[model samples]
Target: MAATRIWSIKGRLDSVINYVTNPEKTDGGKYTDTELQALADVIDYAEDEAKTHNKVYVSGINLSPNIARDQMVMTKLQFGKTDKILAYHGYQSFLPGEVTPDQAHEIGVELARRLWGDRFQILVTTHLDKEHLHNHFCLNSVSFVDGKKFRGGSKAYWQMRAESDKICAEYGLSVIKNPGKGKNYAEWKAEHENRPTVRNQIKDELDEIIKCSYTYEQFWKILKQRGYAVKRDVKYVVLKPAFSQRYIRLKSLGKNYSEEAIRQRIIAARNGIRDLDKPKSDYNAWLNKYEPTKLHGFKALYFHYLYLFGKIRKKETPQRVSFYMRDELIKFERYQKQFRFLYDNEIETVEQLTIFKENVENKIDEMIIRRSKLYDKTDSKTEIKTINAELRELRKNLRTCNNIFIDAERIREHTEYVARLEKEANEPQKQQIKDYVIG
Candidate 1:
């Protein structure tokens, strides 16, 4: 199956252009030396799935791929549509082992042609750096034909999906029969990381309110009093929490949170029947179910960080997360990478991480000197290429090590901040205890 996503690029158009065509970084995330070497060892990378040794194939529709960025910029300038969005970057990713790199590129080119080939300028690149073959399209927001901006929204995405499905069907490829609604990157990332969002918070609130509500009307009243604006519809009930700008449909929450489900839950509560559908509320139950492993070094720090950020024990009932803590969710992915780097290298402490980084740097410097000498040779091309590849991996590792130091320090600071907040929150209870003891 081919999955697709498109997002707008606001700043520099060349950044995205250089990324897709450039060989250094294909997919996001820092790669280990092993992966880099594996990519480098493949000396005969095909140019297309069709006929060349170029592992990646890049094509420009209505423009040259070489200067696609400049052309896109010139079009934007001609139309005076350069103020907001510069370009649109979209990707069509195929399932691994399903399609060859050439076939994937052909499909990508066809899809782009059917969608935007006539009106807008597009740069289609098929990147084979990863196991799954995917195509990246850098589309100019401003159309070259009419100088009109490509109106991008849900409609555009659906249209792209429909065309992609049609093309994939023609190619005898599997398509998503029932694709879920596309969420923005931030929301999707937050959900993936198990960080609490407005939707989750609202679900948690409903879980609590449903227990005490004996009637459907009582439920709506309780929800409104709890700062949720209720909009009853013939088919679906929608709710807007005080903190959320958009109204969320009840059905969107889950099958359990649907209007009929809510009414059934109320009836069950009225009959003194405990809800089997209720959230797993007992922390002890979670502890008994899964034995906690003792973590140390960066791994332990990451666990603690996730815990304090309200992402550690997600199986239990959701808690009302502080608005301030939501911002830290973005760092969860970075911290995960740092943890993996430390664990994979077997570096336990900050000092160990420092030493490891130094070792990588020393190796890099030595390789650079060797590479320089090999460059002077007329017959050392193979050895020089291998050395250059190894050097790039070393430099990438060095950069990752530097980032680990900064991230480790941030984790420490956040840990200390959480401790202070807990202490402040307990001050009143401590004062009450002292008064009782004195009395």
Candidate 2:
């Protein structure tokens, strides 16, 4: 089965064009990525096809060969329009082992012609890099014959899918009758292979935190503490977990995991509604058990270490005693390393920690500037390889510096919290502080 999706290209049009028309994949103007029988006579033929059909005259076509002329032409057409939509990028992917790359490309070109032949100028390129055969369509927003722009909406998308399904049927390929929902290729591939996806991992973490949280804000804060980057937009709540490079939409998780659903669950829990599916232990009963108290610097470090190493439970410990189970001993050794790091860096005071953080920040800034210059200088393949190697080393150092800075910040925050607990004499305030700290 083949699935189709369309998206608007708002900026950086050149990069997209270059990627889809890279000579290495296209096999030197063979259009090997596509099933098109007509071989391209020149490089970046798909881009050239799009540019030839462009109605608006654009400058610097000869001067800037690296820039996507088609995109530049589209931009010129959109100069006076109120709508800022530049171009539409679409993808048509087929099931692995179902169709050859050539067949996929042929179907893709036919699909585009059927869908937008009369109205839009489209360049269909088949990409053969992935497991499944896929086609990329870089369609001009404005009509070449007429100056009208392609107004895409729900109806247009439905039409596109219908057109693709019809083409796939003609090619004697299977069609997905009920495509309930859609996921990006990577997520789909991961799921198809029965591998644990980043989304599933994030959901597991979210479920754990949601079980303990009483409000949406608290849930978000807990996720942040667990090192998830969260961004709330008008329609969806997106989360990028630690070590992940991409964000997953909450709604895409499923009906039970949408933003509204999560909020409802939080409200239900607050009103004493219990989710029978979740285990009782998932909800931390000792959330408010710890009482934060001001101590001398050494005492603060001692308690922090105990808490850090999980020597003391969330609740009070009868007395501080050191035990050496194999795991405990290993953790103690790690704690000793951290203690040495603090001592060696002179991070005993908040002021010193702040200065150390600033230095790390400055180093990161310097690396970033150096990386930018390297990228700008990369023209040849050898230069690119050399620059990438340097960038990788810089990235490693940056990550180490960032981890250290985060650790210092966490220590400072903990110290400040303890200081605040000492200043608050009211019983209720102290209880609130304890609850905030332990949770």
Candidate 3:
């Protein structure tokens, strides 16, 4: 089966181009120097890198694969439409082990051709590094022919889905016949992994409150006292938690936590009966399972930051993280990439990382000169393609090295923050140790 998704890119067009064209799903790091300044506009390196496929699977419509970035940027400049939304990025993913890489690329090319080939330039790349082979499309927001912007609305998505289904049917690939409303990636992953979700959190809190409540009125009153806004007179008992933006209906939390169910649960509670079916979880078990070990250098730094974010579990006092960093905590996967890149490269000291980046940059320059010489000397397409492929790989490496530097700076800053947090969290323990020693 093939599923399609699309979104707008409001940032620099080059970043999206660079990401989609990344030769392999490799590279991670931070900002440094003027190069680092450009890295600031990169939306999510982890997500982009994960979706990057083999260069052989990459194709461009009305543009060259090697110079797709320049052509897209030039088109935007020609139309005088470089502000706000820069491009529209869409993807078509197929079920795992269902189709060959060449077939996937062909399907992607056909999709882009039939959809926007007449009006716009598109770069279609089939990424094979992931479990499911997927195609990534980078479309210039401005049309090359008429200077018109592509509108990506509900109708656009419907058309995309319809076209993709038609193409999939032609290829004899499975298509989602009655696709229902889909959840966002995060929500889907959370549900799949049985992770804590806002809905589950609400249900858990309600369960606790129900045990203490004897009547429906008392139950809502207690919920309000706990900073939850409730609209009890509504068709559905809608509740808005202080930390959440949208109101959640009581019926949505499943039949067990429905308004009538909650009332019955409260009645049972008053009659000396408890809902023992509500599964209890020991949150501290995660901490207990983690073995404390000493780590030095970049690995140690990344480990502690992840630990502070509640990603890593260890038996230790809870450290205070800045309220602003709560969002960052949800992005531990990105942090993990940063850590893995450093680990894989054996990047220990700042000096080592700087030297590595410089080496890659120097190599890229040498490869560029070599490629230029080959283009001038040889009329052979094969030779030119081979050199271009080599150049793409080297360029991807250079991008990763640059990101490593950029992320290293941020990592060091968080390292200091983590140190301060640890010191604060450890102050009581240290005081107790000192008192016992004196006694």
Candidate 4:
């Protein structure tokens, strides 16, 4: 069982972090040297996990552990130097039905007052429904009850852990063993935390279910029953199983059985891959011979880059509000590029789209001039050039974003369009291109 042990003492916020991490201190907290040392050791043990010689690494530092690991930041503002340290020593201990830590602490502290005459102001509360059961206790070094300072957690620390464990046993909760000391904190962390990732841990469970099916047909049915998707082809099969909303491809289930091989087997066992394949015989043969689906997906990457502005935030702590704005702009860019590409690609086939697009740009220019004519006198030439360039550049990107079968013939067509455009970018056509490049 794991735990969440949190403890701290306080003074100046800067001083506390400096002393704990970089240990040495600078100013006044009104506490004497003896009081300071006692508090420092408690912090030392809590932070070092009680090991002067051992190093341990624990994580779940929200916003990154480096910033969130030390919890005192929030509390320091509540109470500062000259104010008595008021910390809530809490933990998610692996004990069930045990008395709350505060109750236990209250009983112990109260008894100490009766026996040793050490009185202090103490506050304790338990929090449930979390990863573990724990409590928070706020007590001053000196008794607010009787104004007496009490020594805490040095030699008396192990006594607390042991006492808590013994108390748990009496209440039918399991007693936890302290693996540290007997084994220092750092060494214990090294011993644990070597566990596997969730994905790897599920591998065995997946194999157990999947291994039962011998052939692709059997596997396909079982997979479908379990909500997995099967894609069929003449060569092999593709199985996509989703786990926790993320999909995984069981590309190679067995040795010598590639996804394509399985897909084809599964399809042949049922019908064939022809149903999903494109018609047009020669092109079909070309795809089967040279352009596989794997080859086609790479062309999609080119399309992905067409509208990319490459705007990066690049900040230490990114202002989260801007992420969605950036994403929306990217999506709008994609929409514009795709619309233009379809409009241009249809120029020869539909002819109407080309005329419609020209009219739309003409209207946009008319509207801009009519609206801004008041500010004119200036050669709005620069502004006109800028907007036209924006239009042309957007169109150019659309041509690049096409995700289609890169059949050698289709590939040749794109190659020619690119070559002609590149050649046209020279001297004579440069002015026409520049007309559109102004933006």
Candidate 5:
């Protein structure tokens, strides 16, 4: 099957022309790369053609092609008075070993003509450098006859794919029955390489965050705190995680992780309702098995101590949990990590944890102050490098401290909220009513 992908080329007309007509790919001016053996009449190469008298033509309207970077610029100037788009580029690739280079080229030319022959001026080139034979089409965005611009959208892409599939089937080539979902070229390449894609990483992070968050706002806040830059688009949310250069569309993740679905998940979780889409966790089971005697302050601390000393037996654990913590044993292992962090730091009390957090903050502040002084005093690249190295170490240390501090604070808040709920539950109905009204 021949897969098709297309996207608009937005920028200066000259640059686009140069890229499509690169001399190296054109066989050093022999033009063997092209399918039709010659560029279309509408595309002019007068200076390069010498005998053409330095004239460019777009369907009988002659102009200087060389002086203005060839027919692309002329076309842009002619139709650009009404439209903003410059050109469109598309790729049609045949599966490896399915078709010969010559066959692929012929099919590509036919496909291009079928798609944009009447309106746009197109150049089709078959590239043989890759394992899979492919055709590249550089089509003018504006119409030659009426100056109408090509309006591309989701419908246009679907139509293009349908045409391609029909053409491939005509040549006795296999066609993809269900193309399924679309992915950009980079994502496709990364998946083929078995690397974790940005979308997958973001989805994993979102799943973890949703488990801890009680509301939409809290979910957003948690993502931001974890170094993601969230942007609200018209129909979907976009996220640019730390160290990433591009923003990922949430809708592109999948139907299950859409913005509306995530919002519904948050609402359901807040109302104590479980969603089938969400994975079940053993947290409630763990709580029930290890119910606290006192439903007041220090419950979190007491549990941490029990967890740290291996007092919570594995036999008492739940059978199933979320995928990340797949079973009771795995969940206990995760708790052990947190328990060790607290125990190794000697953070047995909330007061001690608070002091430890303050010390870390002060250390971070001291490093920042030192770095600022270094920046002011040094202009040498070597000195700057040394300063940056030191700063990076400090930042790493600070991240560890931040994670511990957040966990400790969460424990404190959760324990206090549970204590308040228990206190209310224990009071008489009339006293509870009076308490609710008092303040």
Candidate 6:
């Protein structure tokens, strides 16, 4: 599960940008050499000390050439330097629900302190006045206290958020809710899937066919029924659906399900023989489908792979895969108590969650079995008991899931940025580039 625990901060960009551009803006309102020195010092310190995964450069200042120069003119940042050393955006994030801005800012400072304790060269700026919610994190990019290289990429960014959440929780602040997968790429993918897409429609149809058809003709007939055009030839069949005109053959499915088998499955399905082949494997059945237990199993597999690859250092495995903890179990019951308020009215939210949790529990049992298999032969009851206890703890945490912040703007912003940049490349950028390069 990718991390999505984002810590977002916003500050006066005008002030900060000005300060960065012109050293004169450093003092109070007017920038000064001292302020510039401070920001540079912070960056240097953070880079040296913060144990970072990657250095990420993100910014929201859309640098229109005309306006860009004006901004720089105000800031006095190498006014005539045309060649951009770097094109980047400055941004901050944590998971969907973690700590708020105040807490997140503090966490940034804490990270600096942890990496370079007592060496203060960190500044958190908010860009609230503008039409965006963003933050400027100017640190030394190194710490004097330690020599951990500051990494600022996606993974490091989330690690920062996770540490923030853990610390915030420790400090008694209202920690934002997170499902361990942190609101990273995977969550964005999930959200994107909810939107209308030709690809999604294709997947949906493919899934239906997977469950219903056992052979090529059966598959073809079903597709035709669902408004596809199919032509059978002597050697092979060509399918021209409303969505595409791709030619598919028996070889496409797999080696075992050859042309002969593909046709056979279709025939069997057409004949209404339910058991076309032996039986679908557990994995094949769950492919392109969503099931809580299966999902939990997948999460288990993912972490196992990550651990094996040494992506993250091994800690006592998290008790809850769905981001639940023992402390919040009772609170969850209360939160959902409203649904039970009309138990007889019989809504199904609680029922669904109950089923999901049960499925998760079953997978945990499965996990134990798998663990036993993977490790050296030790079927000791004590070992099993310990695993079960951890499973229980995991169950308690996942029994109630929380993500306090319900809104997201980053994806939309990224989407717009991509579209606009693509458009610029398509239209106005061509002649400008030709002139700039040739002239």
Candidates in order, TM-scores: namely 0.43, 0.33, 0.43, 0.22, 0.33, 0.27
Best-first order by lDDT: 1, 3, 5, 2, 6, 4
TM-score of 1: 0.43
Over the stretch 29-75, how does candidate 2's per-residue lDDT look in tens digits?
A: 33343432223321222121222332111111112223444544854
lDDT of 2 at 388: 38
Please estimate how well model 1 matches the true structure, expressed as its whole-model Cα lDDT: 0.70
Q: Model 6: C-alpha RMSD to truth?
A: 24.5
Error of 4 at 365 (Å): 84
**What are the per-residue Cα lDDT tens digits for candidate 3 across 295-336?**
557666776666665532222334244322433544455566
lDDT of 4 by residue, 147-204 (tens): 4344555534555555555444333244454653332232233335322122322233
CA lDDT, every model vs. true structure = 0.70, 0.56, 0.68, 0.37, 0.57, 0.37
Candidate 3 positional error at 114, Å: 12
**Decoy 4 TM-score against native:** 0.22
* Model 5 lowest lDDT segment of ten: 318-327
Q: Name the better of 2 and 5 by lDDT.
A: 5
Worst 10 residues of 3 by lDDT: 40-49
In model 6, the Cα lDDT at residue 129 comes to 26
Per-residue lDDT for 293 in model 4?
36
Candidate 5 stretches with Cα past 4 Å from truth are 26-69, 80-83, 180-439
Flag regions of model 6 displaced more than 4 Å. 1-90, 93-120, 129-132, 146-208, 214-439
Each candidate: RMSD to true structure? 14.8, 19.0, 14.6, 26.0, 22.4, 24.5
> Which pairs clash inside model 2?
33-126, 35-105
Report lDDT (Cα) of residue 22, candidate 6: 36
